[model samples]
Target: MLNRFLLPALAATLLTTACTEPPKTVAALPILGERDVRPRADGGPADTVYAAVPAFRLTDQAGQPVSNQTFAGRAYVTDFFFATCPGICPKMQSELLKVYKKFPTDPRISFLSITIDPDHDSTAVLRDYAQRLGIGDASRWHFASLGDRAKSFELANHLLTGVVPDSLAPGGLAHNGTLALVDDRGYIRGAYDGLNAGQVAALQRDIPVLLAEIDGRKKGVAKK
Candidate 1:
């Protein structure tokens, strides 16, 4: 009788304790001081992300209207350059040409090249430039205009805020070769120094990371 009571009491105590005590939580891993391989917070990233493309109406080389909505649900890599740029621009274009070769024109992505010299780079000029870079492939690449130098300079300062005076020449156009990596939502996620090989390599690695992040966000896998 005593042994039977002891067994029942022990089982009852365990049941009560389990019900009353809290469960343990596993700890997450850390990475280089950031939160392990997870996506950074909104504005937590070096570049902030916009939910959608900004409201701006522009035209492509084809004279087709390329508005903000044109980039919806699509990621793109873009930089500013004039067709007759004397320095840096050629190298940047070459680097981007490589990037275009790497990723086919998937609907998920596009390559945008906005001419800083839109006045000189008319539709005919841009059309010829596109021809030089492999025009047959229409899926993911574009060369467009951002209007006059005033509008172009304003966007560089107001929107990009990433330009400087050029010293290589007295009155030559001053600029940076940094390529903005925009997400499908038209938010800038990251940037790359398109003129440098090492930076291009880093961009290559980060490109996939960004694409994956985009996919996760769409699937609701990204954490808030």
Candidate 2:
């Protein structure tokens, strides 16, 4: 028969072993889209470059010019919404705010809310919206307008793959309700459903992974 002392000691040893086990490895996030792909000159096979957010110049809520350069060397999350949107826009913003709050003071991350209704969402209008959202840091969170409705839609649909205009849809627009995660190189690394809590939670978890990847790349370049 097993001794009482041996049973207790064995349980303690099992608990200790479980506590000392190595952590499970986490998979890295994936780069998204194929817009940047190109055919090889040799015509052997097409080479695919990771899709990147292209350069753009737009006016911020402060009436300041903001461009892709504004986020150079930084990772950012982006979505499209109009000030007067009555449907998904508010939900999308609320979801995105969770992400913004997650990295409230982290300079390495930024957030962009681009307006699809540029004619209505001027700099002043964007400013008022920012105020309504209680956005305290204009530098970290920008409400911007492309100032051209067609171009805005193009950027939303083609570049960011987020929004689409719908005359019959509520708020005169329909969007994918996605929050795009862009890496430092401007490549899109992930896109999360802005309307779903579970997807947003995944986005929150993935941001740190992308940041760590950026740090790793920097360290590699330094070593070379």
lDDT of each: 0.70, 0.86
lDDT of 1 by residue, 1-224 (tens): 89999999999999999899587553221111112234566846454323433566667767776765777766777788888888788899999888877777556778888777778888778888888877654336778887777777655543343555466642367888877777766566666788889888876776777777667767884455
Q: Number of backbone collisions per candidate, in order?
A: 0, 0
Q: Write down the lDDT that model 1 would get.
A: 0.70
Give the per-residue Cα lDDT of candidate 2 at 53: 80
Candidate 2 segments whose C-alpha is farther than 4 A from its true place: 1-26, 35-47, 159-162
Residue range with the least summed lDDT across 10 consecutive positions in model 1: 27-36
